[model samples]
Target: MANLQLAVKGEYFDAMIRGEKTEEYRLCNDYWNKRLVNRKYDCLIITKGYPKRDDFSRRIDVPYNGYEIKTITHPHFGDKPVKVFAIKVKLTRSNYVAR
Candidate 1:
């Protein structure tokens, strides 16, 4: 099993920049496992500073073979520091799969 690392940087700032409320959640990188082989995968957002699990499925949605998705607050150079977070998921297809 391979791990697909996904990250969301400046998530807090993006909410402020777009004039939207900050998502009171964080990626659940701990409970994530790459052993699951199901087509339908789930990513549980493990909220920091809180003892609860919240699923921000609407905000952080990606398909099985999705490219790396990064979130930043600003577009130009020399802006706010970009905070990077990473998550690992499993890949469905294998190159050595029999044709």
Candidate 2:
């Protein structure tokens, strides 16, 4: 049997309210062989900010108007050496709430 392992790390960035760019960070890995095999690559965390309703149909860009970001780490990957998954949150002007 082959030995394999996987892991994931996540980090949340502070809100940027005047630039117009939301940034996030994370670490992940892809496991090929192990007690369990995992073959997926996706962001374990997603973040968004809630802006007040305005005359504009769309919401201002997050970075442009300062927005908050929250990151979460999933348990798909345990603790092994794999790959790094850097996450970035881009919020466009919109009234839509995060689902």
Candidate 3:
């Protein structure tokens, strides 16, 4: 019944609401590992750009499934393949706010 909060750009936020993005990627360095590894979260709370805490319109709440470590070559990470923790999530809940 816990939650993990994250701040992302508008495009990724929109993509999630559109059912195109299901997993949130985090770098596999010590920073992320300390927070995501062996952590159990019930919800994933994401913000469009670190808006005010009460600004639900710019935020997304999704069910957190879990996470797995993976290696991928995504531009967000850089021009080379990198290791990351792919945090699983879903936007199929009735309470999802698509704004």
TM for every model, in the order presented, reads: 0.20, 0.25, 0.89
Indicate which candidate wins on lDDT.
3
Off by over 4 Å in 3: none
Sorted on lDDT, best first, the list reads 3, 1, 2
**Residue 51 error for model 2, in Å?**
17
lDDT of 1 by residue, 10-74 (tens): 55424423445323222223333232223244442222122223524213322334223235454
Candidate 2 Cα RMSD after full superposition onto the native fold (Å): 13.4
Query: Who is ahead in TM-score, 1 or 2?
Result: 2
Residue-by-residue lDDT tens digits, candidate 3, 41-88 = 888888899888778889988777788899999998889999999987
TM-score of 2: 0.25
lDDT for each of the candidates?
0.32, 0.31, 0.85
Off by over 4 Å in 2: 1-13, 16-21, 30-83, 95-99
Residue clash pairs of candidate 3? none
Q: What is the lDDT of candidate 2?
A: 0.31
Indicate the TM-score of model 3. 0.89
| Ranking according to TM-score, highest score first | 3, 2, 1
The model with the greater TM-score, 1 or 3, is 3
Which digits, one per residue and each the tens of the lDDT, describe model 2 over residues 1-98? 22211121222222422333354323333331221233233322232233334422223222222122234454544554434333334454362233
Q: Which residues of candidate 1, in runs, are more than 4 Å off?
A: 1-5, 11-52, 55-59, 66-99
